[model samples]
Target: MKKMSTDNKLISLLRQSYGTSNPQEAATFLSSAIGRVLKMEKEARRAHITEALKGVDLRRDAGGGMNSKPKTVYKDTKATQEKLAKLEATLQEMKAKYHALLNDGPQTAEENTRLKNRIAELQKSIENQKSQHFQELALLRQHSSNVANASELAALQQQLEDFQELSTQLSDECEQHKTRLKTLEATLEDKTAQVARLKKVMAEVAAGDEANETNVHQLELELANAQEALAVARKQNEEYNDKLLATLDSHLAANHEIDELNAKLVAALDFGQVFADEADHWKNAHDQKYADYEELQRRAEQTQTEVQSKYVDEHQRYKAASRKIDSIIEEKDGLHRQITHVRSLLKFEEQKSSDLTRQLSAARLEMTSMTDDLAQEKRVSELYAKNIRELHDQLALLKNRPVLPDWLFSGSMASGICFGLLFSFSADVAPAQRVLLGVCSGAVAFTVARIITKKNHQ
Candidate 1:
């Protein structure tokens, strides 16, 4: 009944004092109550022992046990007492030994002072050695400085020598350059003179070409006049030959008629003696007409032969001229082929130029894209810089905030409050959203509390 009453009292006390909402606090309160009850019980048992000892019937019990040796109660009690005394003595000795061990450092104050003095002496000796070492280091540094100065001086001297050598080389180079300049200048003058000479030669050649062209023009005009005169002469010759052949054929026809007339007259005179003389005269006329006809035929044959020869000569000249014109046409065709090849080359070059232009445009586009990317990168870097600055300001503000008390953030109180808030939010929010907000709030609160506590401590 007492244990049950004590347990109920402990529960009531815990509920009233610490709010039993937190199990850990309730457990702590209960444990403290149990410790208090156990302590009170121990005091009550000691009080009972005192009262019982005062009213004990030691004599009666000894008399009753005397006949049968009383079951050796006193001996047992004495033995127990002795064992307890020995145990107590051993405990006291162990306590004393422990205290001695605990206080076993330096017993005498003077000895402690002497040890402190010795330590002080050692410290002083160490300090003196350190000072000596520092002094030696300073001396060594001075020696090293001297050596460094010597080395630096040597290096400077070497550099000076190198500078002098470089100066000499430069002077030599300058002299050579001056000589080369003079030589180049002379050569330039010569080349200039040669160029002038070439220009003069070109001018002379141009003059000669102009003169030759004028001469060729005059020759062409003369050739045209000669061709016109030859045409007129040929036409006149053909007209004269046609007129002469017509006249010769008419004379032959007239002579043949006269011969026929003379033959008829002779035959008429022979038929009468009185007309004999007239017959002879007619015969003579007939013979004369025959000779005239023979001459006319021979002249016609010579004229025909001359006309054939002239035609043959004119045909040979025309053939030669035609061959020359054909050769000129062949040359013109070759030039046309060369022109066509040149046109094809020009077209190819135009296509290549267009391709190059396209490539250039593509390269320009790529360059523009790269430039835009670089600009974007620069903007991002600027944004990052701004973010860093903002973060720095926020951190400073956090550092200046006030701290929360330990009791407020202790596991039981904070965990209970956090779980309650999480449950309440979870009812209104989605699971993922609740978790995210809970984690963010928890992290922010913890960080702010830490920063505030640190600031307050400082």
Candidate 2:
């Protein structure tokens, strides 16, 4: 069940890290990630070798210390030996704790402090070990005139081997930790850059929103101004309408007065005609009435001229009123057109405001999507880091295991003995020929063993 869960987790990580839904593609991505880690490990190993070579070269060049092989054979007395063992045990415990902390993933501040303290203790232990080795070397050099006992040499050799083994383990662990730290630091830098970019984009978006808001406010102010202008235009129109109505009422009154005057003029013309006929009759009957008839005809001619002049003046006044009404109507039409144009402008501004609002919403959505993408990338980076750590753990396990099996060694020896017997055991074979045959047999056996080992490793 745990293995299945681990596989499923790895599969999920592959999909998320590489953005691949296909199993094959995800596998490919997993292979690539593993390959990258292997490449990094190879590079790190190469760098370590180069640094070690450089250190050796430096030590060789600095000859005094290199020449003085510290040979002060510090007798591994029981008490000193026990202290060494205790220190070694302490270092082992510290190392185990450190590895446990690393495997536990992220740690709290207190845990981090403990981890640092553990690391310091480990360093101090290593330094102590180094100093003790140096002291032993010095003692051995100082006592070089005397031949050392075999048992003492063997014990010193064993101690040196133990120290080398511990150093190798610590070095490997340190390299793995350094690689992980580098990976995490790189990830952190990338996340920081992304956050900065996002912040800059958000700032730009805010500026755009502010500008859009300002435009909207200005448009609203213009719309209010237009509305006020429209209201004023309407008020003026109403006043013009009232004035026009009043002018029409006065024109109607004038027309009524003109009609009454026309009736009076018609009555006067009839009366004059009757009077003219009476004058003619009187002139025919009596000559004394002729002078009075002449006077009455002159008065009638003057009254006709005055009435014609009054009619002409009234006709001119009516034409002027008609022109004024036409001008007023034209002005009213112009006002209506102005109102329509203002309405169109208002609608356009409203549409613009709505468009800006939609743009703002889209920008917000884009920002949200960007944030999600950054979060996903951060998660993928963390998973990749975890995978690297796991790979390192696996590599460490592989390194600890023996490359060549014990069974292979035994089998190779048995096969070599058998091959020698087959080649040199014939009754008729010469001694010299048997020696040659045995050598050939042994060479063949060794070659076969090598081939088998290589194939098994592959």
Each candidate structure's TM-score, on Cα atoms with residue i matched to residue i, is 0.35, 0.28
Mind giving the per-residue lDDT tens digits that candidate 2 earns over 1-458? 97555444444443433443344544565674455435445775464334433422221233444343333323789999999999999999989976764465444678646744664465456446645665676456445512333344445455555555555555555555555555555555555555555555556655655665565565556555555655555565556556556655655655565555555556656788766655454434443333434444455445445544544555554455555545545654654565455455545545555555555555555555555554555555556556555555654554454445434544564466456656665555543344445545645765687688778776
Where is model 1 more than 4 Å wrong at Cα? 1-138, 163-187, 272-458
**Candidate 1 Cα deviation (angstroms), residue 278:** 5.7
Q: What's each prediction's clash count? A: 1, 13
- The prediction achieving the highest TM-score against the true structure is 1
Q: Total clashes, candidate 2?
A: 13
lDDT of each: 0.56, 0.53
Q: Which residue window of length 10 is worst by lDDT in model 2?
A: 52-61
Per-residue lDDT over 1-458 for candidate 1, one digit per residue giving the tens place of the 0 to 100 score: 99657655654544432433344454566576556456556775464334434533333333433243212112457789999999999999988976765565434667646754664465456446655665677567666755765565555555555555555555555555555555555555555555555555556655655665565565555555556655755775686578567767777677777767666776676577777777777777777777866776677667666665665666555555556556545654654565565556556555555555555555555555555555555555556556555555655554464433344333332344355446745586533343345445544665565577657667
